[model samples]
Target: MKDDKQLEQTEKDKRQKAIIEMIQTGKYRRQSAIVDELINQDFTAVQGTVSRDMREMKIVEGKDGSSCITTEPLQDMHRNELQRLLRENHPPITKILLFTT
Candidate 1:
């Protein structure tokens, strides 16, 4: 049972990696296209599966009105938000060092 679960996770990882590569190419404009491509590659896929992958991967449409989907913008957004929260909530480095010492 454990081995089966590991195999399933490995397959999911491969599929998501393929999805990332396809999205990076900026050719697939929609989830259906991604699903079709995955099918062509002999991987079992459906709209729901692709949609979940996109959501989990933080994929979003390009900001320039293009059909391309990418994770770059979402990554930047998350990075900036994290920085802001850290700036607001984190203690000073000196304080941290003093506590550790």
Candidate 2:
């Protein structure tokens, strides 16, 4: 049997995963929307919980004004490298492209 802390962590993990999925779907634009979707999916989520989850997940608004997860350290390194290359070889880069399916 799981302890209370363990159970709470499990639920938080599940909720955070759902948040990532909803954001990836490109249908949710705001934290309130995410909270609503979580409630619809039978997950208990409040504004404060969602906010904390997003912060822990390192989620950020993309250039296109969409929420995205920045948890990929490798991808971040590559992006930084690409930006450095562009800055050294060409003009100052204004935008970085993110391809999502």
Candidate 3:
């Protein structure tokens, strides 16, 4: 018989795997939707659990409004790199237009 801790871990692992599979389907656009699907699949999970799972799975939002699962989190390092690239490439805006006459 599996102990409580072991059982919990096993369940969590299973849920994580299922979450990945669901994301791969590309049918869910929101975390709540994922949770709903899990429920439909007979997996009892709350929104918080789904949200945490998404974070743990390194899920990111795509430009086309689709959710994508990545191997890395959107950490400060990536954010800093993006900021640096944007700053280096984009010109600074100097003029502010006043519409009031």
> Best lDDT goes to which candidate?
2
Q: Candidate 2's C-alpha lDDT?
A: 0.79
Query: lDDT tens string, model 2, 45-87?
Result: 9999998888777888777777877767335445655764675
Q: What is the lDDT of residue 21 in candidate 1?
A: 75
Best by TM-score: 2
lDDT of 2 at 17: 72
Please give the ranking of all candidate structures by lDDT, highest first, separated by commas. Answer: 2, 3, 1
Ranking by TM-score: 2, 3, 1
Using TM-score as the measure, name the better of candidate 2 and candidate 3. 2
lDDT of 1 by residue, 1-101 (tens): 23787667657766877887787787887788889999999888999998887777677666663344455645654565576468568865763334553
Q: List the residue pairs that clash in candidate 1.
A: none
Q: lDDT tens string, model 3, 2-76?
A: 479866765765677777777788888877888998899888899999888777767777888678867554353
Off by over 4 Å in 1: 62-101
For residue 64, model 1's alpha carbon misses the true position, in angstroms, by 7.3
TM-score of 2: 0.66
Lowest lDDT 10-residue stretch of candidate 2: 72-81
